[model samples]
Target: MRLFIRLLLIPGIVGWLLGGCSEKIDPKPATYSQLLTGTDKKSWKIVSYQVLDNGNASSVIPAQSGLDACIADDILTFYADAEHKLEVSQNAIICYPNEPDIYVTDTWTLFNANASLEFYLPVLNGKFPWTIKNLTATVLTIEYYFPDINASYRFTFNSTTTK
Candidate 1:
């Protein structure tokens, strides 16, 4: 009697928990066109930047921006100006790491490498924490958190033709 009732309850509870856990959460990336168009441009700003390892401990490179966009090959040139303590430095660096293992693909991968970290460009009057994921063209979704503070910006790129 009691054993039979316990068995029934156990199955019901287990099913309920599993069902709740099955919901998928997908976060998308913003598109290159959208970025160029400045559709959601207000969400970000070019604040004082730093080039550091993913651990946020070691400083690989300092701040100074003079990046030339090469949409043809998806490259950004980090020209070494006087601010960067150089004058005739003009070279293009791959936006992401060259290695497939370090670079993120179709999945959400996190790296703990010496020089791999997600950078956040500051936003004027921005006061929220957010995340970007599921990078697609049709959808750009952003979510916010407590005190309505947590906010996320999604970005996606179409072409690799940066030149």
Candidate 2:
């Protein structure tokens, strides 16, 4: 009787241990807006900027495009609020001495089923639309075309913070 009881307990113990190792339920995937803004806000820093001609990478910024190096450290943040505020922080470096450290704009929208982002820049005095090439938890790629130059600029940004 003792041996039989021991065999029964061994199986029960093994089964309980295996049950504890089962996979946990996964949370739902985040939406585009959630990925862009995170829980409350998110900050992104440019990793690469390339100029495209006829859908080909012709040159890279700051090397052939004459873009300032200061732009690489800037942080673009989006807030998940009623206004959907957008802000850019010119960290440590600024292209111009008179430029402000932070630029804020309330006029921003995610349109075309959240496949595109449009934001108004007071300094530029116009609203610009960027095609959302890709947006993930860690990376965001957007493209903008300049009609006058007949070229497209692709910007890849890495998420600095997503909270």
Candidate 3:
């Protein structure tokens, strides 16, 4: 009689303990800023850029006569402190390092809930505004609408340079 009662109590106690536990809590979603500058703080490179017109996206791959190979392999680094850098590997002394993995630093900032990505060239001659379309851990897609030209320039970048 005591053994039967013990078995019944054991099951109930086990169930009670299991029921008291809750499901694992998921990690909090990262903020817009954290999404750009990843936890590893790595640099990114532009995979492809397109100029859209009439809803059609045209590839702006810098393979034209004037654009060199190194120009196509630019890296962008964004920091949590609102400081950004554009490493123009084209100017490296080795001419073109195939994928242009050289070091250069420019400036960039996206602040105060504004989606404007004001990027200043290293030479400070020009600063372009690229609106943040989407930003993820692995991909960043921004667009520039030129009303003067009636064109929308969309640039897609990858977290790592696969070229």
Candidate 4:
């Protein structure tokens, strides 16, 4: 009888202790925006571009193409005519091997001048071994990697005001 009581009590105590120690996790919300540009005139140029980290470089878009730039508080917004109509948006938490606790949200709109269509894509930002940074004003560069596809891409932007 004592043995049976001891076994039952031990199990009950262990279960209660474990249950009480469990922690609750909260889900993070996604971010999205639909911004309207004001009358303030600004322009950006794709002066030079490169895909990935390769040494090769290309001209920023075409010469006659139109580019736009807008500033919103802490973030700068760039817009171009979406002939391709590609748009993407996503939210993700990154657990980088070297740097943890990194979180990012990304949205991209792709347009092809010849295709007369657009691509809208949203993906969770990933943390890579190489740090990703953004440079704005005269030039802006964004680096991203896709874990699902095992690929990475880079975009460069250049901005100038028309007098």
Q: Which one is best on TM-score?
A: 2
lDDT of 3: 0.63
| C-alpha local distance difference test of each model | 0.29, 0.76, 0.63, 0.34
Candidate 4 Cα outliers beyond 4 Å, as residue runs:
1-41, 53-132
Ranking by TM-score: 2, 3, 4, 1
For TM-score, candidate 3 versus 4, the one ahead is: 3
Error of 2 at 52 (Å): 1.4
Clashing pairs in 2: none
Decoy 1 TM-score against native: 0.22
Instruction: Give the Cα error of residue 67 in candidate 3, in Å.
Output: 5.4
Query: Model 4 scores what on Cα lDDT?
Result: 0.34
lDDT of 2 at 143: 81
The digit string of per-residue lDDT tens for model 2 on 1-163 reads 8897789988899899999999999899998888889989998777767778876785555421344556666677889887988887777666556767785455468885758888643323356898899999999888888878768877777899978
How many residue pairs clash in model 4?
16
lDDT of 3 by residue, 72-114 (tens): 4445566555445444444333444554354455666775376
Candidate 1, run of 10 with poorest lDDT? 82-91
Ranking by lDDT: 2, 3, 4, 1
TM-score comparison, 2 vs 4, better candidate: 2
